[model samples]
Target: MIAKWIKFQILDTERQDWTRGYDTARRYFDREGSLDVPYEHIENAYPLGRWLSDQRRAFRAGTMSSTRADELEELGMVWDTADTAFAENLAAARAYYAQAGTLAAPRHATALDKPVGQWLTNLRRPNGLGKDPERTARRAEQLAAIDPDWNPGQLGWTVDWQRHYTGLTALLEAGGTLDGITPGVTYRGDDIGRWLARQARDWTRPNPEQQRRLGKVGVKPAARPQKTAARTNTKARAAKGSDAFTRGVTALAQYIQREKKTVVGRHHVEELPDGTSVRLGVFLSNQKSRRDRLTEQQLAALAELGYHWTQ
Candidate 1:
């Protein structure tokens, strides 16, 4: 493909080389930003191709002398390695990223003619080349120290700790510690990072659908209390109280004062003929039992309040 274009591609019509080809290429090749002559020499061959692929690698990458140009002119054609090398390196780059467990190409990888490893190494920041096993071991030691404080199998995991967590905070909620933490059931940090990029329009832009999905798997906001149900007049409630009903109300009020929100596994509400309603929000955890039973302490409290216990 390039063979056909190579002849005219190097004509240097305005004598402009890599400079003036693209603004970025201009700054990179020559900070001065324009090739005075645009003729026979442009260094840093790597940027030449990816930065500007069509112009026979911008013609600056393999600048031919006028003598060589005239000779080629006499011969009516000249072969160039620019395309062959680009194809080989393009294939190489694909293989490199696939094996490296990454999906991004190096930002600075502006050329396709060099060894993929050369420019690729420039992008492995914060964890260069994955070469140090000792570093990994030390990080593991740090992670192992965090207590696996919460388990999420029952009553669902509390998103309280992670409500406002950034990536770092979220990581802590997931593993309890940064270093000793387990990889997710099926993902790692790199995997999550990639997935996150796709989930949003941009890092800051909002996407409602993505937000809903992330709320489930990534960052969850703590649940706020649902609105309490309507109740009958106070006089109605007071007159309908059986001894059990009276005790339950006092116990529930005390429970609410102690904990802002009631935590209940088994909840019950009853309405009397006079329109009095009594509700019981138990304290036993749903995570621990399918059936709700009062604790010994709770049973004692009710008994003291003149409520008898029965199956």
Candidate 2:
């Protein structure tokens, strides 16, 4: 019994867990040309990926032997995959900004074969950069360096609005005139004339900063001519009401995207891209109270905003 016990101990010592894991990792590295294994990857029924993750955790905790860490490092092991991913995404963002002249891409947009627009949208969300405050600030600064207006939410504007504004800025700089930019005219596929008209029509809605920007670009509030003023009042009122509803829907959509929730606070005010603030909480409350009064089109619009109500 003593001799058999001694033989078992000798066999166990010859097959240490770390030694076996290292051998599998080395074989994987040789075959895949990389050590960036997925967490659930298995090789020859051995959990090579989990084993590598264990090694990384040990290294981070200062429990790994220097020899073992060095061996894994030699095989191109990525110590911090998050940092590596950020670097790659940043590169893609840079490429997008270079071509678009603005980083205000649609959520479905792509660049450099990367989903850079969605990445940017995610990063713009609260705590999107990271949980570490200092690290988040540093990363935000890096993105700011690429495009100071990358996150236009703080500027009280949507990405779509920013994109159109960028095109307008470029056009004006190149000697385009407001008069020549009629309704059918476009800039970078955006109807600049229609956008400009909206800005003028809703001139009182825009905040001071927006007003100043528009003023600098020679845009002013649309003047109401006295000749047909009485005749246009009713028509104007109907049009303005429609516009207000559209703005409210826009504000609600943006709120849902940023907050990732539909339950807005009672006093929650959503700022539209045109700088108008919608009292979303009150708006919703009023809408729900008069749910039966909503027209078919209005009901569909609210449903599209994910505000499905039983009536």
Q: Of the candidates shown, which would achieve the greatest TM-score relative to the real structure?
A: 2
Query: Compared with the true structure, what per-residue lDDT tens digits does model 1 show for residues 213-281?
Result: 455554433344564445346546645533554455565555545554444336655344456554554
Worst lDDT window (10 residues) for model 1?
A: 150-159
Q: Which stretches of candidate 1 lie over 4 Å from their true place?
A: 1-80, 106-311
Model 2 quality (TM-score) = 0.53
Error of model 2, residue 165, in angstroms? 0.8
Q: What TM-score, over all chains together, does every model reach?
A: 0.19, 0.53
Top-scoring candidate (lDDT): 2
C-alpha lDDT of residue 262 in model 2: 79
Question: Model 1: what TM-score?
Answer: 0.19
> Model 2: how far is 75 from its true place, Å?
16
